[model samples]
Target: MTVTAAAHDGGIPAPAPGTAPQQVTMSGAINRALRDAMTADTDVVVFGEDVGTLGGVFRVTDGIARDFGPDRCFDTPLAEAGIVGFAVGMAMAGFRPVIEMQFDAFAFPAFEQIASHVAKMRNRTQGRVNLPIVIRIPFAGGIGGVEHHCDSSEAYYAHTPGLKVVTPATVEDAYTLLREAINDPDPVIFMEPKRLYWSKGSLPEDASPDAQIASSFGRAAVRREGIDVTLVAYGPSVDVAMQAASAAMGSGWSVEVVDLRTLVPFDDQTVVASVRKTGRCVVVHEAQGFAGVGAEIAARVQERAFHSLHAPVLRVAGLDIPYPPPKLEHLHLPGVERVLDAIARLQWDDQADALHLPESSPACDSPASDSKGGAA
Candidate 1:
């Protein structure tokens, strides 16, 4: 499947409430988040391929082994399925196991374990069994890695009924969300954007007691508010959406950005609310467009906000082609320019063209109307 970007119009949505400062690199925040969670709960155990001795390929698990001891922080065999299956078994026995899949593509082998076993155990047992396993997989392309090393396969897990899929774009979220996922009494596929591992933002010293981790579990977070259109994205694409929104500001096109942190049990209320306010919605991801999470999100918006929509839901995604080589990485990945182009398409007015309207027509009559139109 190929990832695609869509466009829409109307007004911007309101930003989410702030719980912590955002100013740490994505990797640094995740490291700290995991450390905090482990420290708070002795039951929390972290293990996976090379995660213990190597501190993980991206260093997200650096120093964890030293701090937590080999029993709590260790490495396992290279088998993805074994890693996940063991995690499920451990969770069933009362330990919170956080397993790390080295890359996005590496997760496929464990699909059966996750989709059929980990995700359904609770339901099958009539809530008697809880699989509190957090599978962390470094995903997405952009660092010029070879195939299987940089694929965005979150859609697969998101499509599963009982799994919760989440990706953190900012450092604050990286720290907080991981803790939340670890604590939740279910299986969560934590997709970490490999390229954004070095991206920085500030994080809280401790998890927010009242922070809405569950709130974003299946819902979207509004990053920026504008009236012209809504740019929906997660993980790596979220940064692209923000950059596109900034560039659109000069063009007088206000773009609202929505970050769907969690894919499964997706927060349709947040997405629907934003789309209703903006009337146009565009979903973006690094995964192939075919049957991806973007399609699911677009379908939900169409169902809940059909009347409020000004244009059909669109998707901006990667090509269905296999992950290309390093040289072709740029073309394979979506960026700000592409997102802005999508917004322009959604805001296009053919009638204005016949009347000799300029190609760069104003997005809205006034800035106040566009800005204030967002949901609070």
Candidate 2:
């Protein structure tokens, strides 16, 4: 993601309802969310490597230490496991601790603490101990980061039954979802797309944070509406899917973009409804396609809307390999061209022929494939 503005209003509170829309960067939105959460609840404390004094590696916590003091927003050692373990202890002791992992891969060392204690404490103790902890990890590739800096590690967290995994694509969601996650009673894995830290967008001054954390989990947001195909994505890939949807129009295709804002409580209703209407679906992400969130989504769509599908559910994802060097990442990450090519392979003619549908069928009617159209 490219930075539209170099600076962020890190300590500004969310605009009151009915206020004018304000331009906000994703990182700035997150910072404001932290400040607001701390102000609202004395129990909320944030700690991570360099999060206090240095204001975080990305400055998402820029003014937090000054606004809330070192007790509320403080720093910790480089021990990832220790940080998370300390958060677990804080949560158990009646505090809403929002701890940061600093980077995507850095969270790996704390998986034992996260998966075993943080995730299961509430259940293991028969609801007597509810760990309202938020493990924030800066994730995904795109910013030309080195080996440990970039990794789409949501799959590991999403696979855990006790954890709620979510990644915000837009600035509004970056603020709203973080606030909601802080208020939730269970543990949440908040994956921040590092690449999108500087991406800017506007939030209605009066708009309330809508990403529900406790009562209803979280719902998917449809970024774009279309009838030809549905492009499903989350986190950093949502922007890519939106871009693909825009480019698909050149080929006379109407594409819908579904942002699965919350992955753990996976919004099947929104995704299935879009797929049913469009009759074709493509799951996009920077994570490996094999056994990734895409595979799970494809399976669910096929199970729920199998008969409605005109073509097989497809995936536009990162290759099933280690994160590549910064120079070679472009080839590894899914781009608009790759997504368009996948869209082209929806078996238009085959679908039309297999169903023996009329020439008016969407598969046969697509203008991009009309040159080879209706060849039965």
Candidate 3:
């Protein structure tokens, strides 16, 4: 990877009074979130490998050391386990620590610390002590990264109790979710899709980076509304789902895209509601399909919206194998064609045929009763 010089401020500055919305990159939004959080709370400290001086591998923490001083934003030895262990110690002392694990696979060395101490601290201590720590892991495989550099490890963290896992797919969410994770009482696994680091979005000029997470923290965002089918995705796959949704329009399919911003505190209501409306769902993810987040989502949809579904829930995910090398990574990652293929397999025929029930069966409803453009 090519290393670039840190920009002067390293983040976007708030616009002056009466200015319009400004465009901000995902990395810039995250940097601004860290800056805002640290500025708002003196207890907030950002530290990890190359986080201070180098501004992190992707420069997401750029200018933090210069702006907040070395003590608040300092680098550690190139030891992943030690970095997390140090953060645990800091949290025990009442400090809110935000630590980064250089890459997705590199975080494996610190899994013990995360799953044991960071996650179970509150429950283990009977609520006496809470570790408000944020573990930022750059994940997913879209940047042509090699084996150790690109692994979608969200499933591992999401399956562990007491840890709230969240991944942002847009610039606005990158800022909002990071702000929420830093202030949350429980430990949070903030999965940053490495490939989306440079993606841009428009946010209000005076957007409050320190905005409190009242009720929108864990809710899924319906990016594009549709009545035909629902495309569930998060992080790097969200862009792919949106692209597929756009392409589906040409074929007269009004596809809905749902971004599951927080995986742990999943908003099943939103997803289920979408599936109920469309009567079909296709979950997309860059991680391996076997027992990945997509499987969990599919199960949840089928369990809650069983009668509403006209076709069985499907998943378009990465092959169940090690992340491929740089050149062939695209073949492994779910693309528009793969997602579209899954959408097509939603069994748009009559409900009885799709469900394998007789047309005159009491359980099989009439095809005309299906929602707009669904099944029938």
lDDT of 1 at 59: 85
> What is candidate 1's TM-score against the reference?
0.84
Count clashing residue pairs in model 3.
Answer: 0
Candidate whose TM-score is highest? 3
The whole-model lDDT of each prediction reads 0.79, 0.85, 0.87
The residue-level lDDT of candidate 3 at 235 comes to 94
Q: Write the per-residue lDDT of candidate 1 for residues 201-295, one digit (tens) a residue.
A: 66654443234454446656899998868889999999889888899888788789988887766787777888888888888888888888888
Candidate 3: 10-residue stretch with minimal lDDT: 1-10
TM-scores, all candidates, are 0.84, 0.89, 0.90
The C-alpha RMSD of each candidate to the native structure, in angstroms, is 11.1, 6.6, 5.5
**For model 3, what is the error of residue 120's alpha carbon versus the real structure, in angstroms, after optimal superposition?**
0.6
Across 290-338, the per-residue lDDT of candidate 3 in tens digits comes to 9999999999999999999988899999999998989999899999999
RMSD of 1: 11.1
Better of 2 and 3 by lDDT: 3
lDDT of 2 at 281: 93
Ranking by TM-score: 3, 2, 1
